[model samples]
Target: MKMNHGFSWQYDEFKQVGTDYGSKAEVEIYDSSHADFRDMEAESIRILDSLEIKRSNVLIDFGSGTGTFAIQAARRCARVYAVDVSRAMIDRAEAKAIKAGTSNIEFHHAGFLTYEHNDSPVDAVVTTFAFHHLPDFWKGIALKRVNSMLKPGGQLYIHDVILEETNAVENIAALIDKLATAGGKLLREDTERHFRDEYSTYDWVMDGLLSRSGFTIKSKHIEGGVLGTYICTKN
Candidate 1:
């Protein structure tokens, strides 16, 4: 699918829907259906081990969907910044944080790519399943922003879909599984619509982002082998 620079979804609309997707969507996608997106797909095991949270370290979950990850990070991380573009998402994240009884978390309802933060003291910038939404040109720009947010020598532990470099068929079961889950209906439709709308040229549910972006590709933790965690080091 070819991505159009101006063919981005209405930011507000997309985010509002995304915010409502709490643990239910995340857990279901990973557990019962879409085996590729299974909880293991988030690369939690690898992320947990690769994470270097400490007494004084600070971490940020860029585009934190519903705070599930933020809550988990707060347990071990001294502090965590959960930033998302949707106000709804931020509210849910904050609510989740409160429910989880985590005090070290700071929630921001702003686009991480454009949000301003002067204190770039974080040890690592953890971005999971967010970068792919960026407009064509901004993918690189977004990476630079995340890179800048990291302290010198900090790490970037990202876990997102690693699109195949070649054109291969998608699993039909993944499509069927989406129809059975809580938010699967919309997720499945939108996901397919997105691929259909965008994958005509330079991309189309293809994998090339992480590989094309030079960040010193480090370790990748795999689940179904198609989905995995990528841990990178900053120069």
Candidate 2:
């Protein structure tokens, strides 16, 4: 087993590269006519479908990563606020919206756990592969903030990559990912700047956050592996 070297390299050598990878990936899609969001487009569609975002309500995507979720969700939601910590990611997301001629989406560059705005209430808060990178306390605080940010009966869904339910050929799949991304757009950086957040975080913290925040743990959908999607609604 070669291990998830691509993920490991990201966790150990290109800090904040998760945000960077997302931003650059959109650049790839924008520059090439035949460029697709790859499998992510399908994955986003599937996940949002599971979330069931309402067309009459507002939805906010936390750490929205180039607006993949935001864009798909706009069809059903009145507006989609795409929030990200990196300006580069926010910029790419805006570019994609313009290219698509969509007017229902907006981009905001803001940290995941540090967003201070609570004025524009949203009906749902969605995050994927982002919460898995925070420690327990931060995850809890984030859920609390999100819960407080939503309108009554508002929904919150956190999707992540877990280690246990990962597919058997995960290592091989990762190797393929490495080869496919090789030189395509590597986040050239030293170890101190890698995806350290994910390497240092886990999913149980999120589960605990839901419990402690008094969020109604409604459902769990394991999509990619043992690490799947968890739906928790605030009461």
Candidate 3:
């Protein structure tokens, strides 16, 4: 994937922040590890349904980990662009796509800051648990780029660890405790590390970023005060 020739001080997204997804071992265990808590296929179908994806539309999955959503989306859309920062993740996703007999997905080893969409504007852009890879400033910049990649009135869906200002500390503690009970020490530590190192921001900040980047927030949903989902349309 060709990178943008931006300022010299651009953030190096390839150098992962919290989890070392670049490691092949991490990539190998991602699916099983996440399966303990998430029904990825069901969640993907719900997202596709929420977007109202049509058979003729094109969609982009920004953090297409392991091709779960990408393959599912490919079955419903004309084409799917699966983009990720880790080459190992991309390779694993590609292998799974092949195994699933999904041929419409185009895998790209790129992140939000580095991905370049050369084709025509896509119908929608979907990302989950991925946007926090960048700090708030870079997230704003990345949203502007995402805005440029969509058609007029196209949709954008974001699901990530966004917080609420009220009882933020207690909420995070509760979330960590919940993860620990659900997936034991491994997931508990992962959740702790995410909050400590990742750049998850407040819901108000995310709303402002989407609005400033030319998106109209159609719907906003926050679960457990830590997980957030925003469905937006290009302005």
Q: Which candidate number would show the highest lDDT if scored against the true structure?
A: 3
Worst 10 residues of 1 by lDDT: 198-207
> Cα lDDT of all candidates, in order?
0.59, 0.63, 0.93
lDDT of 3 by residue, 1-235 (tens): 2346777888999998999889999899898888878899999999999999999999999988888999999999999999999999999999999999999999998889889999999999999999999999999989999999999999999999999999999999999998898889989989999999999999999999999999999999989999999999999
For model 3, state the Cα shift of residue 226 in Å.
0.6
Q: Which segments of candidate 3 are over 4 A away from where they belong?
A: 1-3
Task: List TM-scores for all candidates, in order.
Answer: 0.70, 0.71, 0.98
**RMSD in order of candidates:** 6.4, 8.6, 1.4
Supply the global lDDT for candidate 2. Answer: 0.63
Ranking by lDDT: 3, 2, 1
| Alpha-carbon runs more than 4 Å astray in model 1 | 1-37, 40-46, 171-187, 197-214, 221-228
- Candidate 2, run of 10 with poorest lDDT: 186-195
Write the residue-wise lDDT of candidate 1 on 66-143 in tens digits: 677778777876888888775656776687678888998988766645566656567888877665556555565566
